[model samples]
Every structure is written in structure tokens, then in C-alpha cells.
Target: MANLFLIVLAHVTVTAVVMLLWLARTYMKLKGELQVLKNSVQKNDQYLAGLSSSARAADSRLAFIDEQLKGLSAKLSAFQQNEQSANPYNAIIQKIRHGASVEELMRDCSLCRDEAVLLMRLHGSGPG
Candidate 1:
């Protein structure tokens, strides 16, 4: 009877030892997987942070471009206004805007007939 009890106890102890070893192996695998997941998350976070900063820099560049465009538009508007007020082309346009006829100005002016006609066309109003 004493020998039978010792044999049974020994079997139970061996079984318990095997179970502890299996649990330890499973715990190590789980810990390795958790570490890998944490590393992936950290890398993605760093990449996202860099991307956000780059986006902000791009936004600032776009704003600068927009300001330059507005300044150019203002200069263009001023140039067009000056053209309307100063150029010979503008004088011709204004004469044409008034009611004087191109043919009449050519006749009265001493310019050669063809030259008169050309000048009249250039600076005088259309026949009306």
C-alpha cells in the first residue's frame, strides 16, 4: 500500500510539471506577439506625425503663393488702368467711342487720302 501511494504521487507531480512547462511556453509566445504589436503601433505613430508636419508646411507654401497671386492681380489691374488713360491706342478707342465719323476726319485733315483714311480708321469713330 505504501508503494502504491508513492507511485501515484510521483505520477501527479510529473503531470503538474508538464502542465507548468506548457503554460510557460504559451506565456512566452503571447509576450512576444504583444511586443511585436506595440512596435508596429509606435512606427505608425511616428510616420503619421511626420506626415502631419509636412502637410502644415505645404499649407504655408500655398498661402504664400496665394498672397503673391493677389499682389500680381493688383499690379495687373493698375497697369490696365494706366493703359486706358495713357496709350495712343486708348486715344483711338476714345475717339471711336465719341460720335465723330472716320471719313470726315480724313477729309478735313491734310494727310494723303490713304493715310487720312488709315488715320481716321485708327483714331476716329465708326460711320454712324
Candidate 2:
């Protein structure tokens, strides 16, 4: 009877030891998985931070480019106005306003007589 009791005790002890080893292994696996998750989250956060910085820098550069384009556009607009003022037709029209004759306009601006006559009529003070 004592031997049978000892045998049952030994069986329970072995079963308990097996259950403890299985629980410890499960705990270690869960801890390893948690560490991996933590590392992944950390890496993602760093990547997001870098992206945010890059986006800010890109936005700043785009704003600078936009300002440069505006300045260039202003310069281009002024140059176009200056070019319009420099047109020979504008000078010829002024001369017509000051009462230059059709014959003089035709000679100075290389206009046909018909064109010169039109300009003289449009801009000249009176028929001549």
C-alpha cells in the first residue's frame, strides 16, 4: 500500500513538472513576440518622423520656388510692357498725331500709301 501511494505521488509530481515547463515556454514565446512588436512600432515611428521632416522641407522649397516664379513673372510682365512701348508702330502713331504727312509716314515706316493714309486719318488732327 505504501508503494502504491509513492507511485501515485511520483506520477503527480511528474505531471506538475511537465505543466510548469510548458507554461514557462509559452511565456518566453509571448515575451519574444512582444519584444518584436515593440521593435516594429519603434521603427515605424522613426520612419514617420523622417517623412514628416522631409515633407516640411519639400513644402519650404516649393514655397521658395513659387516666390521665384512670381518675381520672374513680374520681370517678364515689365519687359513685355517695355517691348510694346518700343514698337515702331507706336512711334509712327505718335508722329502721325503730331501731324506728319502720309508721304513721310510711308517713307519712315515702309507702309503702303493706303496704310499711311489710314493712319493719318485715324491719328492726324485734320485732313491734309
Which candidate gets the maximum lDDT versus the true structure?
A: 2
RMSD of each: 7.7, 9.4
What candidate 1 gets wrong by more than 4 Å, as runs, is: 1-11, 87-120, 123-128
Instruction: Give me candidate 2's TM-score against the actual structure.
Output: 0.60
Best by TM-score: 1
Clashing pairs in 1: none
Per-residue lDDT for 49-91 in model 2, tens only? 9999999999999999999999999999999889777885788
Q: List, residue by residue over 1-128, the lDDT tens digit for candidate 1.
A: 99999999999999999999999999999999999999999999999999999999999999999999999999999998988777644544555556545564454443355654565556654333
lDDT of 1: 0.76
Cα deviation at 97, candidate 2, in Å, is 26
